[model samples]
Target: MNLFDRLLLFILSVVALVLGVAVVLVGAAVPIGWAQMELTRHPYNIVTMVVGGVTALIAIRFLFFRRRRDPKLDSVMVAGDHGPIRIAYDTIVQLANRRGSQLKGVASFETVVRQGQGGLVLTLHMRVLPDIDVAALAKEAQNAVKSYLEETTHVPVERVLVQVTELGDNNRSMRVWSGTGA
Candidate 1:
């Protein structure tokens, strides 16, 4: 649950606990001054009952129906000769990035790794240098990333999807020469 929900639940729980204790004390006929004066009165008793009932219901709903966050998969397990080996997804993605970035045409890139039934699926989103062949670069990137991850992690790579998102020489300076330029 979120912070606000948790805080509201806590407040409701405290109120419910206090109300329960007061009810028990009143039922047991312990002569508390506030209980005798306030609780025994007409409007105060009704308002207290309504507020207590609503608080109890809200607390129950919060406890039972709170939103659950999906668990993030940090690592994948691979079978080995001795037993099993755990490889972190971050390591796999880093390897893919290393191989992809090493290619000549690649300027910069971001990668994502998804766990598939047979193995891992890698997706690369990249920016390439101007005048580079985007289609060739994308194909090369897919093969490079797939082979590198499979070899390094010893895990099957189901697919590698590459997208050439941008084409630019980010390090190059551009000069706009007007007709009256120096």
Candidate 2:
């Protein structure tokens, strides 16, 4: 959650907790004159009932609610003759996927693009062939993805992170025959 959202929730929770405690105290006959007087009068009853109901609702909602995070990536601005062109986030991801697919050792991959301070950061989760050199392949994939994305989208790539999640066995036999699998 953001700072402002957390702060608002904190304030609301504190208010609700205090009001709830007061209501409970009055209900239990704690002998607080103001609460007793407020509870006894008809007009004050309406006010308390409304406030108590609202507070209960807010408390239940905030406590039980799960906030979903936004999955959309930030839009990129491009210079156009008439005006600025806004590029959708999915387009960048698509470009990254295409670039990553062209890498020889990759069996499958997923791409995530996000806006960073420097510019865009692209993270690739890739499963590759077990026979390849992981370090060299990762470096090459990073460079290729970075260069292709920047060149194709004209968006500056802050970083291209290639995480090798799995190394498949498809090319192991070929590498073994070629004496390079080890």
Candidate 3:
């Protein structure tokens, strides 16, 4: 949460606690030296005090509570012959890039790997050369990356998603402008 939100919550909790304690004291027939009233004489005063005290306690507890976050999983563990082996995500990305760069019509690419239940999921964001079939390029990239990662890392690939981001002019021939209206 943001600082402003935290500050607001803290202020509200303090207010709730003060009001709750005053209500409870008054319900128990104890005089609240500041405010003089007959709230304790009511038949439902006990119920009101109970609700108020619970609300205040809850607010107090929440004021000190913090949410827990899970640590990031950056490496995958594989059982080796001697012991367990850890494969870093950077290594997988490098392997994926190697495989993708080898494909024709692929100008540049970026790969992301996510650990899944069955296996690893690879997503490739690519910039391909102009005048090429995007569908074919995507299919080729998916197959190449999936097979390459599986063979090299010995990890099963559940899915390979290919996103053709842009058309690159890296393979185009250079042209010179004549400045005139030629």
Clashes of each: 0, 0, 0
TM-score of structure candidate 2: 0.68
Using lDDT as the measure, the top candidate is 3
The Cα local distance difference test for each model comes to 0.74, 0.75, 0.81
Clash pairs, candidate 2, are none
Clashing pairs in model 3, backbone N/Cα/C closer than 3 A: none
Tens digit of per-residue lDDT, candidate 2, span 45-131? 546556666676677677566667554435788777899877877898888888887777777778988888998888999888766
* Model 3 residue 127 CA deviation in Å: 0.2
lDDT of 1 by residue, 1-182 (tens): 57897888777776776775565444445345755676656445555556656655665565565555443466788889999888888888788888988887677878898888888888898988876678988998988888877778899999888878887565653421122435
Give lDDT: candidate 2, residue 128. Answer: 82
Q: Name the lDDT of candidate 2.
A: 0.75
What does candidate 1 score on TM? 0.59
Identify the superior model by TM-score, candidate 2 or candidate 3. Answer: 2
> Which sections of candidate 3 miss by over 4 Å?
1-72, 171-182
TM-score of 3: 0.57
